[model samples]
Target chain A: MATTACFMIVSRNDIPIYEAEVGTAPKKEDAAHQHQFILHAALDIVQDLAWTTSAMFLKAIDRFNDLAVSVYFIHTRLMLLHDSRNDDGIKTFFQEVHELYIKILLNPLYLPGSRITSSQFDTKVRALARKYL
Target chain B: MAPVAPRSGDVIFASVERVNAELFTLTYGAIVRQLITDLEEVEEVNKQLDQMGYNIGIRLIDEFLAKSNVSRCVDFKETAEVIAKVGFKMFLGVTASVTNWDAEGTCCSLILEDNPLVDFVELPDTCQGLYYCNILSGVVRGALEMVSMKTEVTWLRDMLRGDDAFELQVKLLKQVPEEYPYKDDE
Candidate 1:
């Protein structure tokens, strides 16, 4: 498990649909903003690198000092920033959340390429974070 | 020979020829998107989707009966169960649970935790009033009507609207008795 981790689901239209800060360590006031800033900053690199290869899981693509940014690609981009390095756990987390994302998408009322505001999706993602992250 | 027993939903679904889940999901998403663009109103889009489903249901019921080999269901309770159990399975490849029945057994909720229809959907604020799955209800109503059972179907719980599961309340409004072993039109 990572001492600290931030996860986000970036939609196809380049917006964060769902986000969660799942770190065991107590969070600082500026931590979430910094984490989000770092994650967004790495998107250009991730996107550029992702286009070159079809591989979905690109582990530790960028590092911001002590924290590392990892990413997994499906129709949407699943990105994570964490202090601890646990490749297997993060991959499992992405895969499981992807399944949940699919469930969210199948809802006819839910429009694709929109923000995922479902609290149920939020709760499940957090629970998965606790179990995996 | 006696009527062949209705095949289980699981068996029929497994045998059905279908495309990959992603293709099906994307195609539906495309249709809904096109409707929203063309209709320019969430309510209108919803109504059109329901109408489309109703049309499909009236025609699709025959395929459902033939494929599942379900005999005529006399009671509403039995009908709801078969729909939740077998109809949903053969068509969508997922089984739904029947719950929240009233004392009269004329109404019940079809709870679906998993269905192929809901995947990759997120509702915007403007589309809040939309019943995205309203088509399912229309389909149910239209199909039931064909069997001489006038019914009303509605969404009691919508996962897209932040509920736990998709719950459809199917209420029997009236039942029309069929004239059995009848003569053909002259």
Candidate 2:
């Protein structure tokens, strides 16, 4: 399904954290160490999907715009399962992610479908992307 | 412990001063026609849309946390409840409830009491089987799945239909990550 495809783009990004866990590097894999990485990745995906869909909805009037957006959102959630431990910490992390998104939406300059050219937007997105990347 | 009320601005059509959908659609059509004669690829368009949705989800979740102040859901049922009530209310001004919950609470039907996205438009023959404006399903599925619920969202009935109501069936597929690092312990 198109929805599945859109979500895959988000879930695939987590493969690295798993790789990081496997590596003998400094970030050793403790019992729940990977939890944060997984949660952050999911948070990033949610924000990304929301921004992208809002942009598309603004671009045109299509019958399937909502559906398309929904698919992408679902995919981002699906991708988050890889690192979640069903713990309280994960829940709190999502709450924080939710708060971050609301802040972004409140800003006036970052209109839907625009380039998201705001320095603040770029900085926040870059921070998340860099962490996940 | 107290339930959080949704803000005034989050609801769709909450702003009467803003442009209406009909007028907006007309303007959008004219603009698209003038700008790009050949539309881009559907995949490319959807990709762009996903990216946009990603951004919106980020910002929307931020507002949700600040306003609702609710923490995450511990299980699938909790996640579904939170999403249907808090998530939908904050974003779309609708509260979808799960009626006829199955044995495991995995198979459930969503009933939308009020929807703003389909307020004015009729589902023409072209858009029948399509989900009119339920991108939240993807967002919910993806967002909650990240919290640990493996969810599969399917439409039992499209929103644009003869009945005054719409139903979406959500099946909780299974636990996520077939081969998680902690699988051996479980």
Candidate 3:
């Protein structure tokens, strides 16, 4: 049994949109069946964040790109669900992400590349997952 | 750009600016759409819209600050000038001028030289709501409050009245929150 919880907060609306999953996986395999669920879950999280506020919606464009890369980096063998093979400027996007990551770390309110693990937000996400998928 | 047809009290050469129009339309759409969905009473919808616009005004002050890189206005006239020039020009693409400033200073008139939103659309005779214009009032009140001014916004003409020109009444009152968070401690 493997359970992972993740959560995100929207700054403008002060609302938390979350998604979590609890399922049994034989192992974290390359292109594993459970990994598909995780990718789907992450996409749902990104989509909800987009809908929360106008500011958040604009911010999500950048965050979604970063998250796609992060997921790939975390599971080197798993291709991202949203990866576009034809999407040009992959290298430039990565460079920009690296610069932004540095900026995020410099910000007192945030830490660089830290996975969001707010328990309250995760609880809401898990409840939604249980209800829907 | 060609000069817009001037209203009775409007500032000459009222011009449109893209940034202001984008911010205004987006904010107006967001507030109106939300009110129509989440609220039931017309009065409550109005209240919520005003309040939302107030907060938006507070945030927009920051935006104006960042974009214009200007310090606080020295007085209400200066404040009004910014509202006429930078504020409206930034958001609505129109410049309004003060006319017939009241002795109490609580009542002033704004003549619109041109209005993009009003162009090509006629307000039905039955219509009563202020709609997009109230948001501008909220922005003015909130932004001015940062520099210590208390004001109320009222309309002098209903574009719904089928008038070629538009005007709004701005009533300025005694200052509130005379100092800001960063103000020097006396």
Candidate 4:
């Protein structure tokens, strides 16, 4: 079984900028929609917790059975859903994603709170996931 | 002791950090295309770009302050110098020459010899009045506003619009005094 399941990047406005599934688990017909609902549901918890804590990395904020979600909040919220219990590895993943997000922000053309549709950005994210996830 | 000569803007920017010019140019092109498609009006595009730049500038100022570690400017002249030498160099990897100071010294122009955002860009003749580089001016205005220096920034010349040089004019309107909202009334 793959340790990592799904990765998603949600903008501050609660829009999903990017989403990818890294696990080898067989596809479920409703899995994509299910993941989207779960991700949005977790966001409320993230916002409530954000006020009390100043940490960028919020480890294991929510879970459903074996599935767990880890969040990193900078200008946007980067969430990772996985089956494995590697706390340290998930932190590294979020860190790398945050770096790429900053690079995207540096682009004069790119706007904050917009969908990230750059193919180059997508490719880089996948490469990072393959390396670390 | 006599004050040491200030380093030239070019000298300070000589070894400044750099990013991929192609990435910058391509991303800018994509953004322009998207704006045109969505707005469908040349004038509207210009306004949107300026608004976007203002938002970016407000956030970017934080990064600039953290990285440059420079103190607040004593005056508008010094502010212009810092924007040209330090602000532009640190973020854009380019230095603009500050020139054409008005008689009052509250207004000046920044001459950009090379603009990475306009590399390989050609403005359509139909959009003659559009300020392709208006975002730069917006950034200046937005950044200055944050420092309590309310200023007006406009593009005096644009290479994309067939101008000989890229020039941005900045005019100081007034400085906004900081207000403490929670102070008790005497």
Candidate 5:
């Protein structure tokens, strides 16, 4: 069975603004909360690496056995977790998401560091996942 | 005051470099769409745009000063001229005309003939209260505030809203004196 990809958008304040799961990875009981815990735990490693490197794309920053985590940071943090080792696919997905993220920032009503609850934004993210993830 | 030379804008712009317009436009488009979806009220959106622009402006001035190699202006009029001729040209690759001065000569308008940020953009009916170019006003306000000038920057007209042209009215409210909190005990 193919492992599913977990995508998360964490705000500057460390709150997860958007979260989605794509692909058919066999689900285990309590996997949702487990994924959240894994993502949050990885944040500490991400923070430590950020001070040492200037690259926006931090590939394979951490891993737990078969699980690999990729991190991208702009004004906020984008984290991707997957079992596969396709670095190129992960980079492309982050690029498209970054473009969408900047567009959201342009809205007069949308402030930085706030939760993104727009359905339109959610739809666009799903489409990108289908195309790339 | 007498009008400055027309080609000054051209001279300043020619010396300045350029960036890919697509990156600028697409980024701006995404921001506008996001703002519409997140904020339900138009008035709130307007205020937010100004606030955001102010933030951008504050930092942008530092870059403008470093790259343009221009000195400080003696008065508000000169400040207006530099912003129109140099600041806009350097950043946006376009020069706005400084016009419509008030009687006290402390207020003026920067009339923009073209704005690259709103290229291929049309205001949807649902976004009636949206000020598409409000960030520009905020930028000006924020940049000026950083220079110790307290100015009220407002939009007089916006082509994105179907106005005849794009105009930003900048008024010099008062000069804020720089307060030095740390002083040696004498």
Candidate 6:
């Protein structure tokens, strides 16, 4: 099905801090670009939907054909654009990544709202992606 | 009265007023952020943090002594052990391993597998020259100074810098002749 599991962490101020393309199947360069474009386009919708409820997880908020957008917000918005509808796996992935994100945030050296550029963090997120997503 | 045995860090920590870890962590993060912004240079910020830690260390030694029931003037070897086993545990709730001592017993490394001050930190490339945990070195230096041990402390390894653990190399420079924390006793 050429599955797409592109995940992003956007800071509260609407800056993209971390992004990972964790698709199970191989994806084309153009498809990856288009996926990011769609993900960014959905951020506006996410902001609007975030304040409407106190809940952190908004499952499958906005969908475009086979692509589904799931968001988990806590100071930073964790958005995943995936092709499947596994709510449990997506939620688990979000929660685990949140823990990792907090570790990044807790660093006295890390400036808030800056791009997250750690290879270790990237590698762990990819591994978690394989495990849960 | 028989001399009292020194209290364990766990016992002293249990009696101390401790704040929420997250609150403390975030507050420290904010302070560091403010320091960087105000200083505009990572090196300056590092120095400022060390200075702040030095001030805190000097004052903290009094509370540490009164609470831990550890007598002043322990030898360098015992001082390092107490710092690793009791001092860190009392304040940060984590124990450090003391290793890599010189034969003369003038130097050693305090290895911390877990550092409470460094939970959420990843150093950006711009700040590579900065020692994120420099304050810790200053604290050790300042604390030792009060007890008449002239020492130098440096970061041997930092977990933030991709090291396996946090290690501080503390070197005894020269032992000053016994001084007074006893000025008021007369």
**Which parts of model 2 are misplaced by more than 4 Å?**
A1-133, B1-63, B177-186
lDDT of each: 0.85, 0.44, 0.47, 0.79, 0.82, 0.84
List pairs with backbone clashes in candidate 5.
A103-B30, A103-B31, A106-B31, A107-B31, A107-B35
**Candidate 1, position B10, lDDT:** 87
lDDT of 1 by residue, B156-184 (tens): 89987889999999999988888667678
Every model's DockQ, to 2 decimals? Answer: 0.31, 0.01, 0.01, 0.03, 0.04, 0.63
What order do candidates take by lDDT, descending? 1, 6, 5, 4, 3, 2
Give the per-residue lDDT digits (tens) of candidate 6, residues A68-119: 9999988889999998778888999999999988887767667779898877
Task: Tell me the TM-score for chain B of model 6.
Answer: 0.91
Q: What C-alpha lDDT, on a 0 to 100 scale, does residue B39 get in candidate 1?
A: 93
Query: Residue-wise lDDT of candidate 5 within B65-167, one digit each (tens)?
Result: 7766677677999899989988888788888999999899899999999899886565545677778888899999999999999999888899867788899
Best prediction by TM-score: 6
Candidate 5 Cα misplacement greater than 4 A, ranges: A1-133, B1-17
Docking class of 6: medium
Interface RMSD, candidates in the order listed? 3.9, 14.4, 19.3, 8.4, 7.1, 1.9
Considering the two chains of model 4, state its CAPRI-style docking category.
incorrect
Colliding pairs, model 3: B16-B93, B20-B90, B20-B91, B21-B91, B106-B171
Residues A9-97, candidate 2: write the lDDT tens digits.
22333322111121122443473544344344345445555665653111111122222111123222322232222234333333443
Ranking by TM-score: 6, 1, 5, 4, 3, 2
B19-116, model 4: which lDDT tens digit per residue? 68788777777887788778989999999999989998888888777656577667899889889878887777778889999899999999999888
Task: Give the per-residue lDDT of model 4 (tens digit) for A1-133.
Answer: 3554688889878889888887667778866577777778899999999898999999989998888888998768898888877777778878987888877766545566777766667788777777676
Q: Write the per-residue lDDT of candidate 2 for residues B138-180, one digit (tens) a residue.
A: 5655554554567666556654556667676778888766456
Task: Score candidate 5 by DockQ.
Answer: 0.04
lDDT of 1 by residue, A1-92 (tens): 57789999998778998888888878888664898899999999988998898889989999999999999998789999998777888889
Going through the candidates in the order shown, the clash numbers are: 12, 44, 5, 0, 5, 4
lDDT of 1 at A13: 74
* DockQ computed for model 1 against the true two-chain complex using alpha carbons: 0.31
